[model samples]
Target: MSTIKAVRGTRDLLPPETELWNRVEGVARKVFERYGFGEIRTPLFETTELFVRGVGEETDVVSKEMYTWEDRARAASEKAQSLTLRPENTAGVVRAYIEHKMDAAGGLRKLFYIGPQFRRERPQRGRYRQFWQIGAEVLGPVSSGAESAVRDAEVLEMLASLLDELGVKGWRLEVNSVGSSTDRPRYVAALRAALEPVKDQMCEDNRRRAETNPLRVLDSKAPEDQEIINGLPKIADYLDEASKEHFAQVLKALDACGVAYHVNPRLVRGLDYYTRTTFEFTVPDGSGLGTQNALLGGGRYDGLSEMLGGPKAPGIGFAIGEDRLILILQEQAAEQAESKMDAYIAPVGVEQNAAALALARELRRDGLRVEVGDGSFRLKKSFEAADKVAKAVVILGEDEVASGNLKVKRFATGEQRDVSRTELGAYLHGDQ
Candidate 1:
């Protein structure tokens, strides 16, 4: 028998890769905080109805990709409750907001989350069974359609600024508006009529989409499917007056922020909840990891809360795949030098172990990150190990301890010198 490996669609982020993940996460946190969004965590799994209602029953995530399971606790009553490993964050966040009465908080409630989500599907590059998303949602008091569009532009601008600060290049933002339910159905009819002629020529997936989700057929990437979709009616052309005004406001806001964006008439996102103002950020040159390689995407879901049995609260948000962002950062980092470490502590003799440990703790307490050497290693070996991750190594030996001093070795220059015990901390800080 063959040894089993990680499930086909999942991946392990090991050591150096984890470093990149941390960097990307740090950037996300910093950017989100600047926009006044606090972090919120929801359970990994939620009751199945959340997705069934929030993400439409007709969507691929609900009909195909969700990882659903039975709650065995009610087995005695033969009443097994259905649960699903959350496929996305928005529904759970909204559920928590409603359950906790956050709407009563009286202002815009901004929340962000970073965690893993599960989906059951054939995994490919940039698409996984288990993946991580960094998401943010702003709910409450975004009453005017103009305000909603400004908020959308703000979030997208923040995201774009983050990528720019991190040195990521060659990305493009695609924007669209799917219109309200009132306007969308009419547009769907027009789309169906336009597609009826070539429906036979479309791939099987597009064919099924035509009957179930005609808008999704526009999202298909298969070359022939793209050709068929190109000739189809654009959603923007069929938008009602209110929907057109809403879309115009969103684009005007994007322009005010100097955010570069292209209007994509056929950019209907995968989920069913999306209404007006749908957008996606992608690497246009195709140098990223995934096919079509969208780095982030989202849209307004004005009716989702009400659909899920909550009040009529409208919300808008976006989710970015952290793994994909890290992969992109890794590719960028490869062209640059690695980050430097702060300090390393090499304790020379068993007799001086306690003293070295005490000094290490003191340095850490003073807010410096110090890595101590294992007592089993000799001074030279320990210094060699320290050199790999440290700019300077503190060598604590019996002779140095007896003299109330320590040897401060600078790794980059291969220079060694003695410092008085009281001055050791200052010397290290100065060197740093």
Candidate 2:
């Protein structure tokens, strides 16, 4: 019989590597919490209409990549409902915000989440069908100051801090204002006119986008289309005065906080809801991500709440591609010292197996990482196993168990010592 394998586009994350994942999540929790964000977990799937109404039907995530199916009803009277595995989390987050009426709480809802998100798009390096994202959202009623440029700047600053704390090197922040909902229509109109003249020369995707969602043409990554996209109308030129001021304030705060950024006029991210401010953090080539170098991207979506059938709530958020992030960390080859077992208890003989386990228990209870070896193993085999995973090996025998004295050998210097029962813990902790 053939063995079953992991599904395509998904793989298990084994140990040592999982240590890095844990580290990233641990740092994210610490950093986000310090900034007054609480953790949240939402369902992996939601009603298909939630995304259709929230992320927009025209966006590629909703139209092309979603993993959706009809969930059959249990009863004859019940109707089947279309459910989709979330392609992106922002829409679902806004849905949660609306359903819970978090606005009535009268304060900004600062929530962060770390979980897997599904998309059926073709998988590649750092991109997968089942992927992980570490993201946060800050939204609330207009009175909560959620729409302030300060909030935008603060979110950006917090991201900068997060990447720095994570040891991500040589990252660049690109910022732009796509203008507000009121201003976007005017810009989209201008973009449409500009595209009509040159749309035929662009790639097929951009040509279609020019008709369906002209703003997406600005986000094209085709090498042949760069010159054309560059020549297209810049969003900055069409920004209304309020949008210009809001963007200027965001930049000013970034500068004041020593967080650097470049103003890229063409950075109208792939989302339809982004208004006023859009930003992305990217790493240079050789970060193991090839052309897809974005560490994270998000923007100010002032109308997302109302778009999802909720009260007026403005928000800003970002989602870090955690798989891509770990790739970069691996490429950097950062020195992550393996966590060593503090002590390996090597039973001298089968008679001492119980004693060895009892000693291991005591050491473990004292907050030390202890491993116990089988008493049946030869001393040479025991030492070999201990040397690989532990900092020190403690020899346990009938004589030593009775005397409460043990022979401990340091793996590093080949140093050996006779440590008493009470002193073993301190000795393993490096007092020796």
Candidate 3:
């Protein structure tokens, strides 16, 4: 028999690691709400055409990295339908928006989601086959280039503020504009001509990209590819008047908000749908987590909705990989101290299980996190487990329950006190 294991490029977010995931998610939800973005959930799988259309057929994600397959079960009854575990969220979100008629809702629909995305690729550190992303999208009423830029700036600022709130430091933001669909083709042509001479010297992957996605050639990680890319034409210089104006407006918004950013001419995003403002957040030293330390990346994709066969609704959004963000959190934890839990509960006797459950529920109802130990363990063992997880432990033993009181132990101070059930909730809530 073979031992089972997680597939390559995938990871199991264990308990300790899940703490950071929850923390990051909490911050993301709070920050997004502050920006007037509501949560939206979409299916993990979608028809194959969604990616091919919304993500762009020419992009590496659609052409190479997507995990696509036919519905084997449906093949017997009907024509086998091709489906893909979404490699990105934007296309599916757009599909949902169209199907649900959100476009008709009027005003800009600000929505956010946090979930897993799939891709088949050679994964390395900070890169995974299955990754999680916290994404936000704005649709409708993002009319003028200046309005679009301000929206981009707002999202970027919210994301940066989220990291700061979570104590993630030493990161910087990089910004650029990929231009509108009309201007991209001309820039692509210029890029192809510039890379024609050095194509042979570039990596095999990049050489292929030179023909298919000329902008991606500049995204190469290979040192030789970097050298060739450095000498390649700058896309910003090739931007048409509208594109130039759009880029300027985006920068002006960032400046007005006092959000520091640098223009990176070569920072084309991995997807083909991105247009106008594109940005990436990274460690200032240029060494993020490793060779690929870009913590978060996103851009405006104005044509994605139309590409998905919906009305011509332009959209702007960004996605941050949860795994990469967690990596940075771990580094920060090493430099500082980890956050402490609020409370833990232990039922000393099986008979006291209901009491413990009630007390635990009340603590949580008061907005204090409380973990309850299963009644199967001995009281001492339960207390030990509680000590490991919480700063304080509330014990619901038979004597305490009989007396209508609870024994609370402050784990950090080794202090113990007996409180009546009526006052316990108030004590935990700091009302005493």
Estimate the lDDT of model 1: 0.81
lDDT, residue 424, model 2:
96
- Two-way lDDT contest, 2 vs 3, winner: 2
Best by TM-score: 2
Which lDDT value does model 2 have at 6?
Answer: 94
Which parts of model 2 have CA positions greater than 4 angstroms off?
Answer: 338-356, 371-432
State residue 360's C-alpha deviation in candidate 1, in Å: 3.2
What is candidate 1's TM-score against the reference?
0.83
TM-score of each: 0.83, 0.87, 0.82
Ranking by TM-score: 2, 1, 3
Runs in model 1 with CA error above 4 Å?
1-5, 14-16, 72-78, 141-147, 165-167, 284-287, 334-340, 346-359, 374-384, 391-432
Residue-level lDDT tens digits of model 3 in 292-373: 7788888888888777777777788888888888777776663222454577778876777787788888878877878888
**Model 3 clashing residue pairs (backbone):** none
Query: Candidate 2, overall lDDT?
Result: 0.91
Q: Report the number of the highest-lDDT candidate.
A: 2
- 1-432 per-residue lDDT for model 1 (tens digits): 999899788878786567667777887899888889999999999999999988888888899999998888745768778999999999999899888888775678889999999999787667789999999998774443323667777878887898787777888899999899777888888988887887889899999888887888888888867776888888888778888887898789889889899998889886878888899888744556746678889988888777877766778899998777776766656423334455787777677678778888888877766877876797679978888777788877777778887778887687888888787777877743
